[model samples]
Target chain A: MTEAIQNVANPQIEVKDLNLWYGDKQALKNVSIQIPKNSVTAFIGPSGCGKSTFIRCLNRMNDLIKSCRIEGEVSIEGKDIYGPGVDVVDLRKQVGMVFQKPNPFPMSIYDNIAYGPRIHGVNKKDLEGVVEHALRSAALWDEISDRIRSPAFSLSGGQQQRLCIARTMAVKPEIILFDEPCSALDPISTAKIEELIMNLKKDYTIVIVTHNMQQAARISDHTAFFLMGELIEFGKTRQIFENPGEKSTEDYITGRFG
Target chain B: MGLNAKTSERIAFAFLTLAALTVAGFVLFILYYIVSNGYNAISIEFLTEMPRKMMTEGGIYPAIVGTIYLIIGSMLVALPMGILAAIYLTEYAGQNRTTWAIEMAINNLAGTPSVVFGLFGLAMFVKYLGFGPSLLSASLTLGLLIIPVIIRSSEEALLAVPPEYREASLALGISKWQTIRHVVLPASIPGIVTGSILSIGRVAGETAPILLTGAAYFLPRLPDSVYSQFMALPYHLFVLATAGTNIAQTRPLQYGTALVLLMIVLAVNFVAVLVRRYYRQKLKI
Candidate 1:
């Protein structure tokens, strides 16, 4: 056991004693978890259980909230992200995010996909290929190929979400954080996004916060069930669902409680 | 009870309709009065030729040109500062007492009278900066007067851009400045442009701001430069109606000048509407 602790290989992201507060109200309390590389880890909880808040900590998205104060260490690739010397821009570059609602920028389809790369100093010569590659990876290239110059808002909700995914993919982040990405989509769109996530984990570390128990069971390799700002259990999705070691995790999975 | 509800609803509808029509009626009345009195005075030569004699006989071409210059000049000063301030307030500033104080100051500044701004300009730009009674002084004054309007309008526009968009961009590992430039500004440009057009219209028609700062009673030629005092439509109209040697004789000229100023403002508003429509279409919002 001592040898195991001494020589454990670092996970892609390791969060230790992560705590967050919005003004006086604590939102996350002592959350410690290790997310393996090239795997989908689903954060499952009911509303206000800190699942989303915990996921947001991975990329420092909570910094946008005026009252949010974070404590403890969040390391990506074994480097402390909250350390003084860490460049937040570079940290964010390695940790992309997708939002709950589809928020395609008010621009053409091509411009939407090209926005991230262009800002990161990708020249115009390479942008065309980058945009195309991102779109294809997000499974939207075939549908939006002809309407590349058309406004992004012209697409359906499903297509718009896909475009948003493509936009995030353009930055080529190693880890992609999804904050209820399919919460606003139709079931068909939700299914498509699920499939996309499953396929994406082959190349990128994916963290998803979801309310859907079945979704976490279906797609995620690893599952972490949260209850009232505490992680109840963390293990293989199958183990957590079929034979959870914790009663709370079993209750949440069986829909008896959240 | 049903009959009472219906009666009250009908009365409310009537009041709302009357209120809306009253506004439209006043606008129509003003347009009719100006156009009727001014139409005979307007001609191709009147629009093209420079004024002759004691500001009574010829065109307001110089005033028209000067007004355009002032509008463009003021916009150049106000637009960038206002937009940047708004972005900082909405995107970066924490919800603290300092941010609240700055917001309150902007609101108060917007409420400050144009004439007060004119006096401030006289004391500051004209006297202290040594610009004298010139276009530079007047434009800078007008720009100061409208900065609050730009800031308020752009702030509202920036706020109206859904937080979802900002979050989505930030999640992509894009920097804050990049997100604002690419997402927030593009989404909010139409609103900013509308505010700018409103400011331009107000600046074009304002007599009080230019009275002390820069407008000339009559300048023979176009302003040689920003340093030169220039004729402006509002001040020219003021001169024609009240200060000219033959105020009665130049009554038609007053109406004509008023009509021209109104036309210029309307043209600006029309362009604003077109630009807004074009972006709305392009963005498919």
Candidate 2:
């Protein structure tokens, strides 16, 4: 597996010997993988598997959990994120996240996009351009450009989700993590987001966690299957969907069991 | 079983509607009683002139000024202290046994009787602290009485702010304090302001606390400073109705004072309703 993955250039994020516990219960066990630069990687698994938990560990989102305990090294661009003197706040700036729900702040549309830039102390003069560029990148500018001053809740659910993505982009993050980004949207909205994700891979490293197998096959370059706190298989999306390496992976993929 | 369920549902709906109507009826009854007895007594001179004849012959100007002073003074002390304590309790405090105990204590304090707070104020501020029976003492006592109310509501307001906002802000690499200032506090402002206004209404007409700490029997001149003894609307009404030598002659004045106090409370409540409506429309929530 190492020889097969070594042919590619140095991966953007390297995870090794990762283990996690929620108080007395173990949630992730010995999970290790490499994420390539500027590509889409999908973590697909059944519910209660550690796929969501693993994705959270990428940017230390799980640290917000009171009982969560982690033991492993996760490095982004060769620097160990858990190493001494590293600030979690600064680390998150490089790795943005979109939650399962469309969680736009109950504020103006313009204010929602400007929140990140304002936090970073960006000049007022530059915020207008930044907001425009971010909305344009998320393919949302044409729909919402005229009503930028309106409250974010005025947007449709799908538009709100895209606004969230644009908000993540406004911070200029190198990696964007989506935790079931389209689970709340209809099929049409889901298709649009999938297209956006494919186009986003040209400049940003995208990591998505999804329960939908078709979505994983549609947009992902690499796919990792998790089951009961263990990574069963990690390979190209096409190979994993066509010829899974493990029995558990094939059984789960073929609808034998979740 | 279906027939029984239908009858029971109709009975419950009727009972609930009756209960709501009872509340509306009580409010209307009070408004009618106050207005009928007090409106005839309300004149420009009755409002602006100083009381005479050892009881009541003129306006309650001094009491009105003193009430305003006390409200401003107490709010100066209570608002910031209560808000800060609430923020500490909700935002920074760890979820532990100690936090639970503190919350329990605050809830119990809010339920404590008004007169008990008066006793507390008399002992702590007037006697021990040597503030004496002056405007400062009365204001401080009232401030303590209302602090629990403020803390309870402010904590609720802060908690009502969605956790998702905090998560999103932190994910953008914003510090916890910055997130609170820019996102959490802004979103929660409507709740906080409404809570403060409600508390203000409760504190405005309070007589028990001020009766012990300040509430002079007769003061023709306005309170010149915080240290000066003062009269207040509720306390003045109490004097005219019960303690006055000419009780029969002062009856009209007592009703007038009560009406004014009620109007002030209604005005504060009206402002709170307006603010809530405006924000609800703007936020669309």
Candidate 3:
């Protein structure tokens, strides 16, 4: 009876009244959501609906964009990430991100995965084991183990995407954000990424912004439907898909509107 | 007769080919003229031995060494500063008034005449700093003159590196400087090295900047130190062709010196091309 609004008993990430603006245009308006630990939460909306913008806020990736100003609170593990003392680099160490486009470093396959660990001062001796484990987790080790020394560009597009995923996993972040990761991927590749993401939630809290409603339904434990910049419904995926409370949410899920 | 597309295209192609060939033709003509006149002076002693008599003997070796020294010295100062400035502009500086002003200043500085830089060097390094008319003063002045180009070429190289690389590194929790060191700079190395080396050609051939700051055209020995006066190819050629008592007698020496200077510049540029290719292969870009 006295629970907080849209509350999770223990949220790994808690964002409160988060607002964002690019110059004069407000991109995110009063977005408040609590993402539970070790679970998959999918952000679904039409193009430019602020889902991507909101996910970028998790790792402070939006900081790279000039004129992007943020306000309110984004707390991870009870610590406010936007606070004055917080270093963006340290914050990103705990929150990894995968881009829509596959961007492997212009390096060998092993170096791509080893890059993060090497920078974070992981021992050189442990690096081989770490790379193997990360690649195995991303479901890519079996296909390309023979060419570990090959340039990352030698891989197929889907394999490259997985390599990027492995690269992110190498850092061992607490949370992973996927921004339309499958949008550029073919169906088979998308399925593979979906399965990998589903498996990853056991160790990492996963947040994904997706245009495909079925993808959100297929993999996510919880779903947040966004219309324009506002969160319309936040609930279990089954409820949101089968019977959404908000009209806009119902319309979006049923293909009546976006 | 009215021209059709095909006929007009042929005429245009002819004009374009002529234009390109004309430029190449002039370069070849100059090369032929210099090499023909200077080939007689080409001997081991001419290249390696010291100059003798009243400006008409031995070798231009001291001048050659002095030019190399100036090239090395200027690059020592310019390379780090140019690369750092480029990194700051591309990575850190916001699109504020400060960055705008800095960019404008760099561009305007590039267009400022070399003689003006020479004069400034005379005032600042030679006179104010009391370095005197020496190799140190000339090197510093030439460094200032070439920095704008280095900054611009480096900025272009930095811009050519895919932004996706920067974002990828940063999202992996790497710091800005670490990302630059590991990814951006390494990727842009070929471009930076090529541009920097090619600019050395310009540094070798500059006359006025050294004229005010340091070049002596008659130093018997190698510059004893940075503060000592030195002779350079352009100034030696200047003294051979225009100054001194034996201008007509040293005409052959002028052609020889000019040929040597051109060859030095060409040799440096050839090394630049080789280095660029090697890096491109290693980076697999």
Candidate 4:
């Protein structure tokens, strides 16, 4: 396993020997990686290779599954996220997530963006400004700014994904995780999300788990390839895609196998 | 293959349609019989007057008020408790042995007979608690009888809200309780309200619990306190049909009382339907 992390000073997220299980069925093996600040890192692998599970470990989403258990150290910004006296709510606020499917609340578009802020105790007077800023940041402001009060379901799938991104940004989180966010979207929507993600790197660190290898090649600055719960190789996206680092990484990315 | 499949499909459709119409026909026939026999006896005087001439010729004013009170009291006891218990079970309870046991217990409570509830109410609320066969005792009994229904329906509603919503909310750093109050509970309103309305109908019509707990054969006037004895429509109809001085003479009056009871239940249901629709539109789900 080539886990040599290159060209990084002060990594935003660092993991060490992370192992996870679902009722004794090991889902993630000893995996470690260091993700730099202000960069897009993509995790690509075959189905059930634990790429999605690895992404969820960042925000501790696996806590919701009753049978899921973990034994490893995951740190964000030099703080152990899986440490004692930590609140999942507070950690999630700092590290937000966008799911595979766009899940807008059963409320208005404006309300969807404002949900995070309101729950975080943002003043009623400042909510409009916060919602607009988040929407503008997500690049969805120009399209549906006129109908902010309409139900979120009215938006197209791609637009809903942008709305979700906007929803994540509303709380001003420093890190955002996209878990196959474009899987449910069409290519056009996927392209738009890709563009939005590249532009977002200037302000926030992004970790995306995508099945599409071409998508990883197109958007990510750092690429990590996994095969069945173990990290195969981790390095610059260009080197991983173009040059041969590991035989499986070469096989997995060249359309030989997923 | 096509013709045989089509024939079977048509037969199934017809069978389902016939079953539905048969049920509807039974209901319509009951409504028609009640109206035809009771309409002649209904008058302003009959609705307002107290019984006269050995309970043979008068109105059921107190019974009407008593049923309404019972309905309100039972809701007061059941709605908040049922909804909160349901929220606790679905949102807070871990998937473990305790939750499994509670789930089994709730299912059993739902299948228990209403008369058993009446008997339990008699012993617990009436004798042990010293509430003494009053409206309080009956209201508590009916509330307990229908609480399982509310909890089950509420659990369904809560579960119907996709796990994604809860995840989305939690992902935004919202606490569990806040996620439930803001997202989960609001989305499940229609299901919760519909379930509660069905329970309300059962409470309004049930006679057994009230019979052992609160209902009287005839009240001089409306019972002023929850502790006082009351006259309920189902129990009133029961007395008129079996224990009245002239059961044959008051046959029309029995139907009238039945008609009145049906109308009250329907009227309550109508209001609940409007509320459910209003929430549906407002939430736009």
Q: What DockQ does each prediction reach against the true complex?
A: 0.78, 0.69, 0.76, 0.75
- B80-139, model 2: which lDDT tens digit per residue? 889888989989999899999988988888889999989998999889999888899888
Q: A245, model 1: CA deviation in Å? A: 1.4
Please, what are the lDDT tens digits per residue for candidate 3 over residues A28-120?
999888999999999999888899999999999998888899999999999999998999998999999999999998899999999999999
- TM-scores for every predicted model: 0.95, 0.94, 0.93, 0.95
Instruction: Point out where model 4 deviates above 4 Å.
Output: A1-3, B1-17
How large a fraction of the reference contact set does each model reproduce?
Answer: 0.94, 0.68, 0.84, 0.84
What candidate 2 gets wrong by more than 4 Å, as runs, is A1-8, B1-18, B127-130
Q: Model 2 has how many clashing residue pairs?
A: 0
Model 3 DockQ reads 0.76
Candidate 3 regions off by >4 Å?
Answer: A1-5, B1-15
Choose 3 or 4, whichever is better by TM-score: 4
- On DockQ, the candidate that comes out on top is 1
Task: List, residue by residue over A82-170, the lDDT tens digit for candidate 1.
Answer: 99988778888899988888999888899999988998999999999999999999999998798899888889898898998898889
- Poorest stretch of ten by lDDT in candidate 3 chain B: B241-250
Per-residue lDDT tens digits of candidate 3, residues B186-248?
999998997798679879999999999999958889999999999999999988878866988
C-alpha lDDT values of all predictions: 0.88, 0.89, 0.91, 0.93
lDDT of 2 by residue, A144-210 (tens): 8999999999999999999999999999999999999999999999998999999999999999999
lDDT per residue as tens, model 4, B26-123? 99999999999999989887788887786789888888889999999999999898999899898899888999998898899999999999999999
Winner of 1 and 2 under DockQ: 1
- How good is model 3 by TM-score? 0.93
Best by lDDT: 4
